[model samples]
Target: MHLPSRPDLTKSVFGPQSDFIAVVFSPVLAEWDEGAFCMPLLDLLVARGYQVHVYDSLSLAQESSTLHATSENWDAYLRANYPQIDLAVGQAYGGALVNSLLSGFLKTCPRVLGLSAPTRCSAELQSNLASILTCLDMQGETAALDLLEYYVKPERNDKYQPLPPTKVEESGIGQRLRIGFSQLMKADARSHVNNYAGHMLQIYGAASRLVNTDSIVVSSDNRRQISSGISGCGMRPVIEAPEIALRLISDFLD
Candidate 1:
């Protein structure tokens, strides 16, 4: 099965005329070819009249470490790019990035949505992730992918095929992976979520082994949570079942 060529992250934009803007961040390990993982949600947001911006977080981190360093930098970057953002949506590690900025960066208190995002990272989780990176570095891409699959246990979806394999040595991908995981390990979304004074929607898959769903909670007046019991619907509920994910997100955004 041939997969679509990954879209260039820097050139992709959908829903040009909508007043509302949404920025999506891709998962850590999938950053090299983010479009494969993020396109489903991006297309859905565009169809729903939202001007969406999809970013390759690993790439951005490589370009500038300060982008995620503080709330000030995050606020400046968003305000400079878009006149306003109605909502912010993130997946997995990307969700952690969004969560880190919500409390201090977004002044307008836009609604926040997180899909299979972890609120905290334990020492064990960090060590396990580090081991995956080591596998990628010492062994090869195949070994890394295998270890990651075992750890994340992502659901298999026919609609979305796996991204084409790439070498860790290509385009300094190994370094970027290291940086991304480091950021993820340090991310603590609980304080940010607790401090955020806006509506929130969190969705998780019942079979997700990557993120602890119980640690995620919404304190806003308007809060919704969904736990899909679909078989093999792991951390990537969006990719495993885009239709259901879109419907739930669209309904919540409306």
Candidate 2:
């Protein structure tokens, strides 16, 4: 097996001695990418002179010969290395990981904030997921492969084709892991958002509500979601993140 290699994470970003530190976690699909919705916030923190670190949960999960990179592993890493990290930000599946980490890490900080994070797992989607997982033959090791054929990969006569491009680049967190992980997350707390449904729900919810707050950048695409159906719902005013990111970081460090 090709053992995963750790990215030179510390070398890529600036970590200042400021009072607060913001650690951004990536989606469960694994491997943290630079294009994450919250990257701009990290840039903003860097500009303000607070220390910033973007934890590559994907990288850690794959590269750490010792760790599996699930939500729990990510949480443990935070407790060990950043027992003091204050503010955290994540998107989609990333939001779930960050939220879980906060439940534990917040003991070190005063308060925690979630951007488009799901508070509970969805209980109504079980039958639908069960049907889907059954069609994918989720009982064996090839379960992930089964799901890809049914969901992630374009259905065709041949099963060997290039996979679809994900919102985030990098592939250590394979389609099997992504989809299988998502399916298992249907009702499980640790798995749901960090799994799939919650991630999409949070992002969808955030897309609809990004106009009211000043914590994040409201992209034109997000603006469109505000007017059109996002993931499924209509748009509304929500928190913008730039200022929130800065303030959260300041508080975390102090």
Model 2 misplaced regions, further than 4 Å: 1-12, 29-31, 60-69, 123-180, 183-254
Kindly provide the TM-score of model 1 when superposed on the true structure, using C-alpha atoms: 0.78
Which candidate has the top score in TM-score?
1
Tens-digit per-residue lDDT, 10-29, candidate 2: 22345567777766654343
- lDDT per residue for candidate 1 within 1-254, as digits (tens), equals 11123243243456787777787766776434645676777887888888877666553454335335633445556655566678777777777777777765453556777887666665656776788777776766666766777667653442323333555454555566667776776667666677677767777676655665453555544344333333456777778777787787778878
Off by over 4 Å in 1: 1-11, 62-72, 154-171, 220-231
Report, for every candidate in turn, its global Cα lDDT versus the true structure. 0.64, 0.40
